[model samples]
Target: MPELGGPTSAPALLRPHDPAPPLLDAARLGVAAHRGLDVEALLTWTTDTADLLPLPGTGSTAALWSALASVAAADVGAARVLEPHLDALAVLAQAPTPVDLGAVGAGGSSTWGVFAAEGPGVRLEAHEVDGGWRLTGTKPWCSLAGTLSHALVTAWVSDDERRLFAVGLRADDVLPAAGPWVSRGLAQVVSAPVTFDDAPAVPVGPPGWYLRRPGFAWGGIGVAACWWGGAVGLARALWDALGAREADQLALAHLGAVDVALTAARACLVEAADQVDAGIDGKPSAVLARRVRTVVAGAVEEVQRRCAHALGPGPLTADEAFARRVADLGVYVRQHHAERDEAALGRDLLAAGVAPW
Candidate 1:
């Protein structure tokens, strides 16, 4: 991960001994960012390096999150595309009967997205068809569905159950909705609803296993790591501006505050990664994930506000790259669910009475 200041720079997110640190190239990502949302180039890059990202809970989870943060620091939009593809690979790898990437996509360059978000009145159902399964109806929140080769989708398998299935996005019947996505941030990512008209599918795990798996919680933490990285990018902008000229007292104060927030967020992530590798104290993974995400999200919010205030209107108005980074981070950090997630964590903590001091 990138640092903010001299000597007292933020702690390295990846350990010095981690072998996977060299696989991520900031220069390559910076070049890719100049392409402006070319899905093919980005997806191809993701495919080539998909296996290099460390799987969560595999004892090298810090390296995984660190790599994610590195990608976001280079370009949040690129991270937007890369994280899910890496996540989809991890999900398949953790499946009870793991699916083979080669079997799913030709030439080993398949890009995948996870389509698990559900919306009101939107129903995607899986049914037994000719000794196999098929999906029907619409699956909302299918990001990059139009461009990806495959996706791990969650759909209703019965009246009361939903299971995850790996489906080819290029299947004839799969329809990725167009338009209605007008967000300035993440303009490169097209997160529209995808309708499956009897699309063929293969189940990744048994009913409810997707959520029950430990990796599910770890995946959520990985996303928080990316949020932390995005915040780091904003902090770097402020740091660079301050170094360019004689800075005022107020701007210096903002930089100090940003450092404090990022320090706490990084510590939370490091501790959570350690716990995940140690089997999470035999507790539900959600507890650990929620705690880390809440802390990181709060830190990200603070960094955004402080960077904006310190930099004033200059970066947002004149610097295109800085403007996009701010916008992309703004949209990406919302994955944390704000107060709703906080409420859920509080209820769980109260119910468990763990006395986490």
Candidate 2:
């Protein structure tokens, strides 16, 4: 709603017939990445949307719906950019010390990693200092790299005493190292290496709390929502192209397949949102988040296939926006972690076993 550079920079409550809130800001973030504006503007854009978070607090379906809309307008890059900020907000909402949610609600991003076991692995170490705590270590896959003013970092205390810490990145000691992400899709959302050189920090939760928290699964499902949005965005190409040109029987078949898969995907999201909200009564939430992600990812992949099959390489190569959208969504939905997540789902599935009709 502030003067972001792409999509609908003009603010409004909602699009004419759309159920989504004002989500056009994602377009601005997407174009900001494409335009090579750096992460500073991205930070600024994310910080401006204070009202976007659920008012009563975090964990609301409203937040998920809003994120879905945001992702739909731009792509998953925009969703990925804002997701961690929401993750931190959710963390703070349930934190021991009440952070000024209004103040910290502004822009920033951080990512927990796919790091290796011991060795020179990316780990943050915490020390009990006079003032508070200080962190020193390398954190890999630090998205938004040097641009964000703050980040919720994961660090180790002693042994496997891993904890999440809120650290100020604007401080002099912390160093965000430039590293190559080397992916065509999310190249704009940089995931460089960062080092905290005795930077002052505060513990977000007790040891191992980051993983134990319900917000972890909640945030994961939110990413699924982005993938769901991306599926919608990518499928739009099919909708428009198919409508404009006369479709043969095969083309109609492809369109029909896309519709069915997307219907299932959308239903998954709506059902998942209800599940997430229902789980707020201290129950474990959304065993189906990974399942939902897999469903949406499959739907997105199917849509990509059907769109390409129906329309061929002409529109893909010819329409820059369409091509870019397809590529971007392809890379972004991979946050699903493929079968690794599927394995987790399998374990849960086995634990729950089969249901009898």
Q: What is the Cα-based lDDT of residue 332 in candidate 2?
A: 79
Q: Point out where model 2 deviates above 4 Å.
A: 1-38, 55-63, 100-120, 280-286, 352-357
Give the TM-score (vs. native) of candidate 2: 0.81
Considering every candidate listed, which one attains the maximal TM-score? Answer: 1
Error of 1 at 119 (Å): 0.3
CA displacement after TM-score superposition, residue 144 of candidate 1 (Å): 0.3
- 1-357, model 1: which lDDT tens digit per residue? 347642123335766666555546655555445644777788877776666767777888888888778777767887788889888878887888855444435235677889889899999999988878889999888888999988999999989889998888887799999757998999879899999999888888999988888788888888998889888878888888999989989988998899899999899998898888987632467888999999999999999999989988998999998999999999999998999999999998898877788
| TM-score between model 1 and native | 0.94
lDDT of 2 by residue, 176-223 (tens): 876677877767777778877988876777888777676666667667
Question: Which residue pairs clash in candidate 2?
Answer: 47-107
Q: Tell me model 2's lDDT, rounded to 2 decimals.
A: 0.63
